[model samples]
Target: MSEARPYGFEVVRLARLEARLVVYDWAWARDNAERVTENWRRRVAGQPALFDGPVLLACDCAIVGEVCRLSLFETTYARFLAYRDGGSPDGHVANAFAAIVPWSADGAVLLGRMGAHTANAGQIYFPCGTPDPGDVRGESVDFSGSAGRELLEETGLDLPEDAPEDWVCLRGEGQLAFLRPVRFSDAAATLIDRMETHAIREDEPELSGIVAVRSAADIDAAMPGFVRAYLASAFDAGARARRRRT
Candidate 1:
């Protein structure tokens, strides 16, 4: 596939999100235990920073009104990683994640490049991570909280507690990415400086650097389908609007 040619996905606008913990057996993980282990071993050998820990996977999802509700269950990261490279063996579950789409006041959106030690090394996308047990409050998973937590952990930047309620889900490649758009009053350059400073101070940073997307041209192959879809629509529209105002 061309760098970004195969990157195709559907975007769904959402005003709210609800994820509930579910009891379901993942037959793929169970059925392919040996394969998952071998794949994970090879990955770790190349990138020792990867961890095969607990992560939540989506069992079911339905968009009702402005809300995206998901039924999720815990699974090993190794299993999810295995399916990410190889097509889903069971065809029912997906590695659902939440991401914070950081937009600058000047209509620029920022994406992060993964560090070499990461599983997705060299890939560029919004700061995100799969839902885990900590994301679950009682029976419901707080995806918004998860998104904010990931952005902060990855960039050392704090999102406002009062970010807008708007949300979007990009569905493709057996993954459901719940994205919450958060705007920064600072310009994209300023945001990049702060993030780079944070990375320098950290002992082990997840991101190697940040790239700002100002238009569809800025969207590229390093991003997954979901990330590409969002930027192609949102950033392109934003650029058009800015031009019209000019």
Candidate 2:
């Protein structure tokens, strides 16, 4: 297994997910409750639709062989928003979520632009959200289920059970985005059409629209740093694969 970088994004492969319940005690959120509440108030004032729902945060992460273990604890989305917007003043904890990488048959992948009503409006990335109570099973979290639900909610694509299930971990700026690549039989354009149709019917769709990404060149500033890093790495991998095939 390769080592993850300290600052910029590093793609690390994983064979399994393991999480254990931890006691809730985020000192930053406690010490700054007044400030955090004020920030959330202002945020909701701007985006009234944002939800302060249940969410999870990783207190610690460690990779052992093919296993990726995390110490997780539940928290409110409002605290998460404040922590994220405050540049993550609490260095002890970080946001860890899973999302599916929609790789199509035509060598392009799909990303969605978050709608204006969403917390991350205008951002383009794979369909994923922070793990919530629904992801919890016993003392651990079901990351695969979490990723699948997000994809279906945003893209309306129900990935087949037999699709390729390779996993990659994107680590950067205290955020861990677990990406599971699902190769779709449909071409990128065809998949986009399907997603558009789905969006047309949603009362308030999570994604404004889908974009096809062939390489890092398609990445834009709207994409989060971790997402851009994955794109760059994905593009480089594609180039290397092409070179070897020739």
The top-ranked prediction according to lDDT is 2
Clashing pairs in 2: none
For model 2, residues 1-246, the per-residue Cα lDDT tens digits are 544442388778787877777787888888888887998999999999988899999999998776788888989999998999988876888899999999899989899999999999999989999998888888878888899999999999998779766678887787888999889898998999999999999999999988888977887889998888788887877798999999
Model 1 poorest ten-residue lDDT run: 1-10
lDDT for position 226 in model 2 = 81
How do the predictions measure up, each by TM-score?
A: 0.93, 0.95
lDDT of 2 at 37: 94
The Cα error of candidate 2 at residue 12, in Å, is 0.9
Q: Please estimate how well model 2 matches the true structure, expressed as its whole-model Cα lDDT.
A: 0.87
Q: What local lDDT score does residue 201 receive in model 2, on the 0 to 100 scale?
A: 95
lDDT of 1 by residue, 78-176 (tens): 989998879766669987989999998787888899999988899997999888999999999988889989899998889976789688888877888
